[model samples]
Target: MTRHFSETEVVAILDDLNPARLRSFVAARVVTPLQTPQGQAFSEADLARLQLLCDLSEVYDLPDDALAMVMSLIDQLNTARGDMRALIQAVATEPDEVRGRIMTHVRSIRVTGRG
Candidate 1:
């Protein structure tokens, strides 16, 4: 089972995080936490994102809007990576000739800089 942390636990775990900052993050819709009967619940992924947010804020001193944009780009990149993984798996299931043809087309596209 995935471990979920309470708001308090999250604040405790992240050294630079405070209640006010966390509230701001939630308000900005940057780091979304699960709303449970007990209160807000954060997953491991949320924790990692929060850590990254903190690092970015400290390093770049970016505003909420800029941070959100950067996060959005990161999300898109991750989704594309996942899609590519699925595509690779699907292609791997094809017969040798099909795979060879696919590779040839891919190589030609790369070499000619065309789709």
Candidate 2:
């Protein structure tokens, strides 16, 4: 099972992320945590993201709007990568003839720069 960190524990791990900054991240929709009756709990993914956010904030000095845009783009790219993996797996199951056709079409598109 994946480990979950409480709000306090997250702050402890990331010293730079004080309570207020963590709250700001949540408010900005950058690092979302799970809400439970006890309180908020962050998963490993959230922890990694929060760490990245802290690094970006400290190292790059990015403005709030710019940071949000960067994070949003990263999220989109991750989603696209997952979709690409699924598509590749689906294509892998095709018969050799079908796969050959797909390869031909793909190579044609690449060479001609058209679909």
Top lDDT hit? 1
TM-score of 1: 0.96
Q: What C-alpha lDDT do the candidate models reach, one value each?
A: 0.95, 0.92
Q: Which stretches of candidate 2 lie over 4 Å from their true place?
A: none
What ranges in model 1 sit over 4 Å off?
A: none
What TM-score fits each model? 0.96, 0.92
Clashing pairs in 1: none
True-structure RMSD, every candidate: 0.9, 1.2
lDDT of 1 by residue, 51-82 (tens): 99999988999889999999999999999999
What TM-score does prediction 2 earn?
0.92
